[model samples]
Target: MYHYDNYDQTLVDERVAQFKGQTERFLAGELTEEQFRPLRLMNGLYIQRHAPMLRVAIPYGLLSSRQLRMLAQIARRYDQGYGHFTTRQNIQYNWPKLEEVPEILEQLATVEMHAIQTSGNCIRNTTSDHLAGVAQDELEDPRPYCEIIRQWSTLHPEFAFLPRKFKIAVSGAQKDRAATQVHDIGLQLVKGDDGETGFEVLVGGGLGRTPIIGVMIRPFLEKRHLLSYLEAILRVYNRYGRRDNKYKARIKILVKELGQDQFAERVEAEWAMIRDQLLLDQAEINRVQAFFQPHPYAELPAEDAILAAHKQCDAAFAAWFRHNSVAHKVPGYRVAFVSLKPLGIAPGDMTDRQMDAVADLAERYSFGEIRVTHTQNLVLADVRQSDLYELWQALTALDLATPNIGTASDIISCPGLDFCSLANATSIPIANGIQQIFDSLDYLYDLGDLRINISGCMNGCGHHTVGHIGILGVDKKGEEWYQITLGGSSANQASLGERLGPAIAKEDVIHAMEAIFQTYREQRLDDEAFLETVRRVGIEPFQERVYGDH
Candidate 1:
């Protein structure tokens, strides 16, 4: 993780002080609610349904043991004992009092963290692959690029206020685990034909009330022109993006209106005009990149007798290996997943003790490295095979090892109506009801890996657009009803699932899932996953089973 320089520290201190003054003015009746709204939003403070919520940015989801401890401290002293890890790789506290937020900001500033640009219609946090710097397939670490954009976009004079909020994601892995395609700007790091590192940029893709997969505007953007090209795209969006309606203000609508060819041409024209004039300095990129360089790692043997002995000795260790362990670059090392989603627990909720345990485990077993995945889970990046048994032992004590990493029961659920004011219904309980019915891990493994994503509202925070089994909550006649979508995914080939039928009542959700799974079991070919089966035979059979034919 990058430590803050004195200049960086000064900037954060100044911003915190500025926000404190703003809070005092608002409370003193000098600034009206309307006048103070944007200011508070810029500071990452939101007025939720019941109380004010504060979202603190965890840049690129990288947190040190000290930082994690501080966050846990903040949660315990200020709000509830738990914090929700969001899809954008940030954390939120739903019950912070308005007066306490400035103190929270000062606390966060002490640790080279803040809430700047976390909200409002400006560039938000720049997220990267959570498994950066250690992933085998990465061309370069993505965190430096994220930091580069963070510095540039933070209070950018021209783009401080735009038509809507903008988000950007970067992925260096061949597999798109970061959901790059659904972001406003998605950057895939690639090597040019000339062998220089560059970006394969995708533009205008977003998920809200409207969902569109971004178009590939820049197939191979050279390294030098990165910022210039981004500025050009933003310039075009700022000038031409819709302002008439909030729903239509996103850049996706503008891209759709222009069509792909015209949009590409306009971006190219815009880029060509200013590529050299506004290029970010080369020394700056290198300086930022140097901070994120991979640490020197010790070489070790491929085979570990300790890991083998553990697997041979225990049935539980074998089950965990089947789902949680992933191959790593080093011969003797591996990446192990610690499922935050224990059977009935909230998806990404972790207690203070749990956080401390994880921090200790990271330092003890993984060479002081921890990764918080975009899936709202945690990863032990370099857990030596020899330490697997001890790591599992410690994690088991914390309720972090459920042996379900990407199974039917390992659902991706948002806080929904429980925390989000925009949500139509409660999402957590809906997921709990469904999980209770599918509690059998043996049955889940028998059915194979399935993605069951649930969102409480149409905002798509849970990424319902790409789940293999997507459930979106909608209000029907003042009752909670879920609209299910089948065969969606966020991978190399991304596609939005189609609706099964009319929305089903909350009470009927688990039954609907049973019918849907049973349909897949009956219709799928040998060895096919849930997504393949649904794609092979569209959503008809599932729809028939769920809604009983027309």
Candidate 2:
């Protein structure tokens, strides 16, 4: 993880103090609600349904044991006893008091964390592969590039107030676990024909009221020009992106209106002007890269005898190992995912006690490091194989040892009507209902690799656009209705899901999903995953089963 230098520390401290003053003024009536809107938003505070929601950034999803403990303390003291991990690799406190938010930000700053750029129409947190450095298939770690962008975009004067919020994701892995294609700008690190590392840049992709897969605007952008090219793109977006309507203000809308070829040309023109001014040097890249060097891994055999024996002896440990653990680049090491999606709990919600326990586990087993996944889960990226059984035992005590990683039960959901004022329907109850309906773990494993993502509204905060089984809540008359989509994904070949006929009533959602599952079981080929079957069979059969007519 990248530790803050003096400059970083100073900037964060100053921002916290400034926000504290702003918050006090707003409360004291020096600034009206209208006047305080942007100021509060810039600091990641939002006036939600019942109380304020404060989003705290976990830059590139990296956290130290001390930082995790700080977050736990904040959750315990300022808001409810739990916090929600979001799809953007951040955490949200849904019940924080408006007056105490400044204190929360101050506490966060002590741990090299902040809420800046987490909300409003500015560059948001830059996210990358959660398993960055240790992934077996990644060409190189993308966190360095993400950190570079974080430094440049944080409180940048020119981009401080863009037309809409801009999101950027970078992935150096062969598999796109970061959902890069759905971001405003997606950068895939790749080597060119000349063997120089560069980025394959994609532009204009986003999910909200509209969903679009990004177009590859630049096949290869040199490493030295990464910052310049990004600046050029932002410049073009800031100039041409619509401000007349909030819905139309995003860069995706600009790219759509201008056409891909024209947008690319405009960005190139802007780049030519500022490329020299903003070109990053080798020294700067090296400086950032130094922070992400490999941890001191012990030399071990390819297989651990003790771990193998435990797996053979303990059925419960074996189940968790099979699902939660992933192969690491290093021998005898594993990257283990801790599932926050239990049967009745909110998909991403973790209690203060659980957070403290996870911090302890990270310190004991994973070199005091933790990474938050885009799927609203946590990861111990460098867990030794020998420590698997003990780690699993501790996680079980905390209710974090759910053996459903990619299965249907491992759902991704957003805080819909329960917390978010923007939501048309409640997402947590729907998610919980679905999980109850499909409670059989054996059945889930039999069905295989299904991603069910539910969003309370069209903001796609839950990433419903890319789930294998995508559900979006809608308002029909005075009641809540649910819409379903099939065959979406955010992996190596990302695609938007196809809608599955008309919306079903809120009560009928579980039944409809069950019908879809029944259809899949009947129609699937040998050992076909849910996504594979959807693509092969198309959406018609599932639609017919769920709706029973047209």
How many residue pairs clash in each candidate at the backbone level? 0, 0
**Reference-based lDDT, residue 242, model 2:** 93
lDDT of 2 by residue, 161-264 (tens): 99999999999999998888889999999999999889999999999889898888999999999999999999999999999999999899899999999999
Off by over 4 Å in 2: none
lDDT of 1: 0.85
Superposing all C-alpha atoms, what RMSD in Å does each candidate have to the true structure? 1.5, 1.0
Best by lDDT: 2
Itemize residue pairs with steric clashes in candidate 1.
Answer: none
Judged by whole-model lDDT over C-alpha atoms, candidate 2 comes out at 0.93
CA-lDDT, candidates in order: 0.85, 0.93
Best by TM-score: 2
Worst 10-residue lDDT window, candidate 1: 291-300
